[model samples]
Target: MLLQMKKKVLFILISVSFYCGLSQSREVDSLKLSLTNSKIHDTIKIKNCLILAGKYGGFSLDSLKKYTLDAIDLSKKNNDYLLDGGYYFMGVYYSEIGEINKAKESYKKALPLVDSISNKKKFGQILSAYANLLSETNELDEKIAYYTRALKIMESIGDQSKIAFTQYNISNVYRLTGVDTLAIDYLQRALISAEASGQKSLKGHILNNLTIFALKNKDLEKANTYLIESENICKETKLNLLCFHTFLQKGRYLDELKKTLEAENAFLTALKNAKKRGAPQDIMLAYTYLGKHYEEAGHAKKAIQNFEKAQEQDPANAERIMSPFSYMSWSRAERELGNYKKSNEYLLKHVKIMDSLNSEKNKKSLAIAEAKYQTVKKDKEIANQQLELKDKASEIQKKKTQNNYMLGTIVFLTIASILLVFLFKQRQKRKNQELLTLKREFQIKTLESLIEGEEKERFRIAKELHDGVNGDLSAIKYKLSSLLEMNNKVIKEAITMIDDSCKQVRAISHNLVPPSLEKFDLVEAADAYCANLNELNPSIEITFQHLGDVVDMSKKAEVNSFRIIQELVTNSLKHADASNINVQISNRNNLIQMTIEDDGKGFDKTNIESSGIGLSNVQSRIDYLQATVDLISNEAGTSYTIEINKETLNGN
Candidate 1:
């Protein structure tokens, strides 16, 4: 009942794009986890986006687009080179959804960015992708040529997985041109490549093609084996597109074995999965295969129904996804049912589409265009390499000429060069010394402000304890003594304890908020403090003297100045074992100078670091006052001459 069955056999049913690998859902989850929640737009995030864009495929086009656009935006933001990857993935997405024209445009944008095929695997994949687009308009020769180029790159790199994809595409083209022997041979080669690739999902797709070829050969046993193996792989990997084809192929196998009911059931299963896949091509394939099934069974009305459904797919997918066989089968069905007019109409339409697709003149033009494109690319590479070689020769010649002419000049400049380097080093050394001095000055200013605040806080706290809590302790002690009997031994001991506590508090308060330093100025304070120290320690004769006109200074300078003199004198009594210490203070031109001479054993200046906190405390106060000390120490005595520039005090 079929008209011209051998001549009207349409091209292969499956049009597989370049499937690099199966990107698992968990991998997508892992990449999303690596991305921070705060949305820092940086290079690290952009790289994650590019990798994630490549990771999304199959049915998750939405996520693929999301990360692709994210990568593009972030690459532009960071001035990076990842926009090419975005365009490449966009082409894949467009092609998958049956947007042939948009996919072509995206591939064109990506072509210039990819490196040469030998250097970058992405270049070969992009080439294969552009070739896939060529298949839509029946540019079969151009498609095969591009796939051959990509195949050579894959083979050179030993990427069996990529080799399998290219082989499968090339075989499909051979099948389209009705070269059955070569098509079958190429499919066998592709099968070997897929098995060597060891990608289980890819092997499954290749096996599906093998199942179709075996069925066409009417080798029922081979077809059964291939069908079972591929079906298992499809189910295991959950490759939706491959699974749909495997199911349709199984229906054909079942029909060959005369299991009519099971064969129809398999076709319906394919239809269900096709609808869920949401690709118009897969849906059309499912319906067309089902229609072919009923046509072979002599069910004219049922075949016509399925064929009509196949033609009613999305118009956007009409050019790329529609099959020529649907109209041919519909014409055959109408002719068998006494509808000559409708039959003629359907047959004419099918002939027109088939002629357009298999036109020899169009194929020649496309082949020439493809040849020109390849030639230009090769010519450009050759030109660039030649230019580089010519530039290198010129550069070498220029260098030789310069060396010959400047031989004497080079000898003359050597001595001058040495002198210039010596002077440069000297200048650098001077600059470094100046930097250290500036750093020291800044450090002194910071410590002066901080230590000055600390001193004031201590004075305030000492005053609070001396004026408030000491008064309360005396009042309590007196009240307790008056209310208790004086003759009781317990009462006497309690009062004695209270007296001891009060004395301790007063001693601490007096040491912190010293009476001389709190109430008198620096000169008066120094004289009074030394006189009180001599009274307290009668064995030591410590004298204090002052000279020069008093200069106005801030409270910080006054407090710190007195503290420095006090600390130096105290150090002589504690560590110096000084029996006779004399301290003198003089002021002139906003500069105050102090001299402390002790008749005690002087300490090693190197060992000053190991001395107690006494000298360090003095040094801190010295920095606060913007002062320096010159020490002349020996076994007989130690003398400190400290000078303070009152004008240098800041935030005093």
Candidate 2:
């Protein structure tokens, strides 16, 4: 029974995660459409392309690579100097797909151009990417060097976010190299930087890594503290990715502490969150860990199931992200279950992966050795060049002494030219700002016009349904009633059916644009709807209460507020599975406040997709009304409070 409960919880987690991914996919689609339809600057287009590429990288390598190359081409065509940024993305794509050699080449291509870029932020970013590539390939010394360089640049620019990120990467390298002391030191530095930056996401990530280090050292108290802190940050910020990693770390810590049931729940939660982010690497890790847990618990069948799932979800670069132990564990489970052939197959796959890893390690070692040799050779060449320069210095000194006055005059003119250029650039910047502001105003007006048109269309549709379709249904019902005088059995049944059909048509018409809303006010309409809902679904109780005198508002405001309430009620019925619900509205001091509470299993707010269309519809209405909505949810129940100012409603 306990195992069944665990499985159920795990399933819920995965479902929630999958829904979140779908929501994100929809957002990505909208962004793509906007990019395609809009006539933006080439630089903005390039940025959007890169953003899309990063979004797709988790699921589609081909798309990632295509967008990355497109960005590079666009940058070159526009002379944007974003070529280094493009190459950095290319490196990231290659690394993610397990093309180590290609990743290395891309990083090398990006490194030299970093210094030429005008954006210090991009320069720091590229340096960090190069460092990450080095770390991935086990070039520890080079990784540390590049990370340090990136950190210095970030510090010089006073970018605390980048400093924290660089420090985190350096700590990861140290941890991978088994330099525990150095890892802990860098992690502490990262924490300080992250705190100073005031970025919840970065702080959460650093805390999660610190928790892992604490777990590795068997410092249970420290691990728990860090995990709790990280989880809190994730919850507060809705950083699903960080939350997923923290859950995974917590599971491991619990497993070590011998709390098997709690550990199982933690792993399942991790799996759920990973699925939400739709990151293949994270999903694969969660599956691998769960499989291991099940195997250790002597559930061979369950273990095999999870292992198969992990394999199915594994990305093209699975060999890089997946642990060899996953394969070994699967083989063991299969063998134990008396599936010798399958066991052997898994064992062979594990062997192949191990061999490939070994080969890659050897290549990396050789590359490092070659790099060292090249560095020494370059040093010697530099020494030779310095000696030659020294030899020519005496002759150059005599010439310099003769042209000193002329050189000074040239320097002064150069300074004056630079000042003129600076002044001209400043004037151009102001003009550009003006243009940008105008563009923004135009976009805002366009959006508002579109929204207004949408509402007008909805009103037209509602009128048509009510006056046209409902009128036809009413005419038919009246005709049927006249025929009911025949008193035949078929005629009586037909009349009853016609009566039922008429009622349904009227109900549909009312739903489109509630008669109470048009004739009365929002509070009365909501109360009537809630009463009807209670009659229809006696299994679930609903109550509506209103306080104070309701103020008059515009037709649009009334319609939107009613629709928002209707959507919330519909959502509760379909998804909340609550047996009881309460709604209250209060009007005072030129403000209207509405609160809805339900006794149902609360959902993960981080997984926005799980909220579905009903919540989205509610949001749209609230946005139209310019109202404020606040939600509080937990496993026990969910509540929402919305406030609308009467002045705002009047203005609308």
Candidate 3:
């Protein structure tokens, strides 16, 4: 069971990895198709369908707004419990481009959807995105709650990559709440999953988060390690935006280590790269870091100059223009300069911004509450509508029930007819098989009888030639020899002719049936055959190797073996055009094995069975002895192995 589970897991991993390896353009289309197919007129499909619609619509702000509204309309048209989830996506899209209120409003809309979502995976993604937005804006508790919900869903589905992302976001929530140890723990888990999955983008994202966590914990060594990893993965993947961000992190790590010169260089590099990319958030982040670095180096003028530059570049509604770190730096710088009024002014401005950010979050909470109330009210109305729908559904069901009985009767009759036909087919197949078996048996018997008769007739003729013809010629030779001593040239010529005729008759008989096998042994007969085969084809080489005991089998066995070998050697010479042929005979454990291997113009195994009769004849002989023959042929050569059971040996 454990092994089976491992196999299943490996299969799943391969499938997921294959999909993940597709290019971004392919993934978009695949995801779109998946989303389209997911629509089932049920709440789950409706939720996913709207999410997909919103995603496609989010190519630009104008398109995003248009698509998001369309999604909202669809969600309402479906009037699903998961309707709020679409609003969350809208909020995220709006917030991304600095529309905080719009973002909050959309997030509020998503809350009701989350409440009614039947699908865990869909709800989890929604919660995760919303949680991330909340964490970024400093709603720590709310962020943690949503992340937990998302993480649970991810765990359920075994989606390790998304689970890692959710954990990383959760860690950020912990970091926001000043829980550094827990944050580190979660981030480490996130890192493991990310690396295991080869999710380079997610890994870089997690590493960047880990860098911030390490910096917060004052673990400069740990911070640098993660920063280097993040930078390398980002650069290798050409994640330019991520690479741009990692520079600022590296600068912070250097500053933490008190390498002021190196830190300044890092900060400058980060600013230049971020400016080149024209990423406003990254540029603001770089300036924030550079300001702190300059302030720590005791360059108050440069510190103030960098801080003011960051504020100017920050978008008009940027809530966190003076980052928490920047505010700390600004406060210290003002106090050091003895400008009490300016110090208080900066402090007051920071407090005001923080207050406004908090107020925006509160407004979000109230909006969510209002949305929830509207959702509940809508749910009640839907419930009443469902009650009416149920009555209509009952009427439809009554009609369907009557239709079902008729359909079932037809189906039953159809199934019975199919069963009858199947049984008849089975009966016919059995009859056909029996007829085939009988025909094959009759064919085999007739062929065997013919072969036996032909072999017996050839043996008789060979005996006649060897005995009668050779004896008569020898007698004529002796008579001629006696007369040739008296200058009888005609007689001598006649004797010579008769002697040649006698020799020709002996050769003919030997060719008809191997003579050595009757007089000598298997090896001698094989040697003589090889010698004659080589004579016929001088270009072909034949090697014979015999091992272990050799037994002289019955005439029938010998004749069959000789015939098979003769055919094999003939075919090799005529068609194989082989350079070398090796015949190996081995007797081991009371079994006889013959192997014929040739370096020839080899044939393809696929084509061999259909191509000619040589293989068919070989197979037939092996089948007669209930032995096995395996022919392995390829482009390089051919190998044939025939194994006969020792127990079945005719003369054992």
Task: Report every candidate's CA lDDT.
Answer: 0.72, 0.73, 0.66
Each model's RMSD to truth, in Å? 18.3, 24.7, 14.6
Q: Compared with the true structure, what per-residue lDDT tens digits does model 3 show for residues 96-192?
A: 4556566667666666555434656556665666555553343544655677778888898887777876777666655544456887798789889
Which residue pairs does candidate 3 place in steric collision?
A: 84-110, 84-113
Better of 1 and 3 by lDDT: 1
Question: Per-residue lDDT of 79-183 in model 1, one digit per residue for the tens?
Answer: 656667778777766766656699889889988976784454667777776886675235655777788898898888888877877777776665655566887
Q: What would the per-residue lDDT of candidate 2 be over residues 1-652, giving only the tens digit for each residue?
A: 1111111121112112211332444566765665676577778767667766655543455676787798899899998556765777687666654466787788788777766346666666667766665543556567767777878888888987678777877777656545679888987998898789775666776787777778778899999999989889877866456667778888888888878899899999989977875655667778888887888778889889987787677546555556778888888999989999999998988898889768866765666577678889999999999999996998999899879978999999999999999999999999999999798667556545665686677678877867887788678768877876777788778768867776666666677667788789888898998988887788999999999876567776777777777777777888888999888889899888888889988778888685663366677667656689999888777888999988866335
* Reference-based TM-score of each model: 0.50, 0.48, 0.45
Candidates sorted on lDDT, descending: 2, 1, 3
Deviating ranges (above 4 Å) for candidate 2: 1-39, 48-70, 116-118, 135-138, 257-262, 276-278, 314-321, 340-652
Winner on TM-score (1 vs 3): 1
Worst 10-residue stretch by lDDT in candidate 1?
A: 1-10
Rank by TM-score, highest first: 1, 2, 3
The CA lDDT at 251 in model 3 is 82
